[model samples]
Target: MNMNKREKIYLIAIIVLLGLLLAKSFYLDEYKPVTEDEILFREYVEKVIDDKFHGFFSRSKLIGYRIVSIKKVEDEGVSVIEVKSENEGEYKNAEIDGKYVAKIRKYLFHVLPYGEDKILSRK
Candidate 1:
């Protein structure tokens, strides 16, 4: 069979597309935003903390919440918020972290001094 220029172009396009799909299975290139509920959860975490965050958590229930650390890792497309809660279940989110990671929702995450690490810092 004789192939024309158009036929060659079509064949190249198909091969390129297939190559992309295969590469995708092996690697991730981007991150999609968290859902609305995830955004709300982040805000809720803004509320949960301990005395280390007293300057802000003092007046509100956000106090006494200590987030020793947070490490952001990506899986598929969602962000896994790894937090060490000073107190058990201080920062609980049943729907989000319930399956992907265990013990992730146990601590207070907003322990940083509110309004600023020192003074004049932004929250």
Candidate 2:
């Protein structure tokens, strides 16, 4: 292999860039031991999401709606939890396979979902 100053710099830059990207991804997907609060929060979110699919003539028609992933973000002085959910069921004889993103406010006693549910897919 022939060594050149410019080639060495470029190679080093590429390696550093790749290392940074790998670190960022691992940080973003960091895993932590599940706590009681996390479990409770997930359950609460599930109930809230399932209720959204209810209709006037239907009584708890939604089933298998689950919190697929959760991410926490801080804005201003408040902590907002972003939840991604996968829902599957039959609503009024229509097959539903849906994905949703819900923003929730973290509170002392309970977490409340705010804003409209962002539908990622419904088909």
Candidate 3:
């Protein structure tokens, strides 16, 4: 079929628009809410490590104190932390410091996108 000039132009425009929209959807990865639990869990790991390095962690002598577990808890404020201890079995009640929590927030929004893991990389 022979098409008019205007019709051909319109068809091209529609194709371009659809391609752009498709690319954007793939880039966005949908609306994923990280939730308070995920944030809290990440903060817990950073805090626990900080404490251990500063000599404030008492459970250092435990078996699994070196292993950091970051995950959202089923029933609790945000997420919970569980550290494996040698003789003590598992260490609980891992607390996150205010500074470390802020650091995690920065990392998630800014740093992770660029494949940077540093806390200040978000800037």
lDDT of 3 by residue, 64-120 (tens): 122112322233232235444355545555433222222222112211222212231
Q: Which whole-number lDDT from 0 to 100 does residue 28 have in model 1?
A: 34
Q: CA lDDT of 83 in candidate 1?
A: 36
The local lDDT score (0 to 100) that residue 37 gets in candidate 1 is: 38
- Evaluated at residue 99, the lDDT of candidate 3 is 28
Per-residue lDDT tens digits for candidate 2, residues 1-123, read 997999999999999987775564345322232654354345445555656655532343322232435433222232223334454542211112223233432211112222233322211
Query: What TM-score number comes out for model 3?
Result: 0.28
Give the number of the best model, judged by lDDT.
2
Model 3, residue 88: C-alpha shift (Å): 26
lDDT of 1 by residue, 57-98 (tens): 345655333222232333334333423356875554333432
- State model 2's lDDT: 0.40
Name the weakest run of 10 consecutive residues (lDDT summed) in model 1: 114-123
Ranking by TM-score: 2, 3, 1
Q: How do the candidates rank by lDDT, highest first?
A: 2, 3, 1
- Score candidate 1 by lDDT: 0.38
**CA lDDT of 18 in candidate 2?**
71
Clashing residue pairs, backbone N/CA/C < 3 A, model 1: 49-64, 49-65, 50-64, 50-65, 51-64, 85-107
The residue ranges of model 1 lying beyond 4 angstroms of the native Cα positions read 29-123
